[model samples]
Target: MNTIEQQLWEYIDGDLDEFSKKAIEEKIKSDARIKVQYEELLKLNSAFSALDLDEPSMSFTRNVMESIALAPAPVAMKTKVDKKIIYAIGGFFIVSLLFLFGYSIYSSNLSMPKLDFNFNFNLDRYITPTVLYSFLFFDLVIGLVFLDQFLRKRINKEH
Candidate 1:
């Protein structure tokens, strides 16, 4: 026969075979020590099961919301484009390029001793300026649209 201590563990864990279970019950009838140990384990299990299920404080949600609100409300939704700014920047770059070309043309005509060199037509020079200015314009428009939406939302909220 198995000891009461080992039987009690198997019984608590619900892992005993029915014959083993019956044998343990029969042993418990004659053993006061086993019965007392079993009763103490049962009481401990019941006490653990009866814990309180109360909710946290109402201030918990409010505190979380307040903390989120206090965290500097996102840098006012900036845009990738602003049309007026783009046009102004584009105009500045175009003027600068024209000045550069004029200076280059003037400097090229200056007297130079005979040197064997061939001028290479860099397609990049033209493509780079146009592409850069166009992207700037696109970004400016996007930024302006975003700014407009942000302002409209703010105005609506105020009203």
Candidate 2:
């Protein structure tokens, strides 16, 4: 009377313990409906288990190895960059940096147009020649530090 499909599958698969196995066996013997269902499930299980697996060709591995050996080793996918293109890009960046440097120096020297707002304070008074020069030196040091780091990284990358 206790007819769970899963228990029947477990029974068919030989997974149930002795007590459960005996209980199902008694149920099947006493109930004609349970017996028919159990037989049908066993038949389906047997049909699935009896299927023949397709075997591979005898020289499958040899054919694979031969094909691999015959073909050229796969070339790494890398762009074939021309030296001229790299130089052109470098030249462009250098020219831009030079242009910016010249513009900054030129603009700093050019006469400033008169401002409508009257200011009594002068920035140059606070930033004396010594302070200005010291700031310039610090800026130069920072630039050199960055340049050194960049050059070291570039050298390591090339290696």
Candidate 3:
């Protein structure tokens, strides 16, 4: 936006600081151009204030009333779900996961599985620590970017 528009908006909104407001007021008083612009803004503001919002179409109320009439009568939708049971079920799942994870860790050496391939692909020529780390980093960054976009779209979605 232009500086004039910026100042005009700030002045209109009473957002200008005392010094800036005084400077603008002085400019408005001295320069006919500034004075005319100020007058135009004032007129526009007054016009907006005097204006009434556009009314809905004539059938709007009838449509709404008819829909309401056709709809089922208002009834509260109170939930009958038990909170304690939900909490208990959640607790059960958490405990089961923890137990299973602990058991797996305790019983395993966390060793890499030996791959017995029939053909020699010379995988060692391509697979290195740097390549692995780079791949992991790329995947992490892609995942993070995907997650960020998903969350941003979800958050900005209208209710």
Candidate 4:
């Protein structure tokens, strides 16, 4: 709105200081345009004051809540993840570890070592098939636990 209308509104609302109020009153008396506008605003303000404010029915809030309750619960984004992808990744790591273990065993020298120590340490007696298998199983279990923890941390960071 123009400055004249704004000043007139402030004047009508009794929001202006004495100096500004007196200045606006002088303008309203002298300017025919300002005088007409001021009258119109006064009628509009009176009409607004005459209006009765509307309130919603008491059941309005309850009806809205009930409708919201009828809708399905939202599912978490993490819960939507495909199990097959996780299983495939886990399987790949397991197969890779198994291949690496097999390669290391195949390339190692199983022959007896010449030792100068008084206590004879025989490698063959300790490095049996059962022991190797147990070691590999233990490493696989530890790897799976670490992978699980890593995946959980990564998932939490993403969300």
TM-score for each of the candidates: 0.29, 0.43, 0.34, 0.51
Report the lDDT tens digits of candidate 2 across residue range 1-159: 454678888899999999999999998899998889999999999999999989989999999999999999889988564576567558656865875675465446444457544323345556567975785686677568656766886797689
- Model 4 is weakest, by summed lDDT over 10 consecutive residues, at 113-122
| Residue 10 accuracy (lDDT) in model 2 | 89
- lDDT, candidate 2, equals 0.76
Deviating ranges (above 4 Å) for candidate 4: 55-80, 99-111, 114-159
Query: What ranking of all candidate models by TM-score puts the best one first?
Result: 4, 2, 3, 1
Writing each residue's lDDT as its tens digit, candidate 4 over 84-159 gives 6688668868877986776576556455546533433445666688987987797788679867977997899799
Over 1-159, each residue of candidate 3 has an lDDT whose tens digit, in order, gives: 778767976898899999999988888888998789878888888899999999999999999999999998889977565576567557656765875675465545554447543432444556567976885686577558656765776686644
RMSD of each: 15.4, 14.3, 16.3, 10.4
**Which parts of model 3 are misplaced by more than 4 Å?**
55-159
Q: What is the lDDT of residue 31 in candidate 4?
A: 94
Q: By the lDDT metric, which is better: model 1 or model 2?
A: 2
Clashes of each: 6, 0, 0, 0
- The global C-alpha lDDT for each of the candidates, from Candidate 1 onward, is 0.74, 0.76, 0.74, 0.84
Off by over 4 Å in 1: 1-3, 52-159
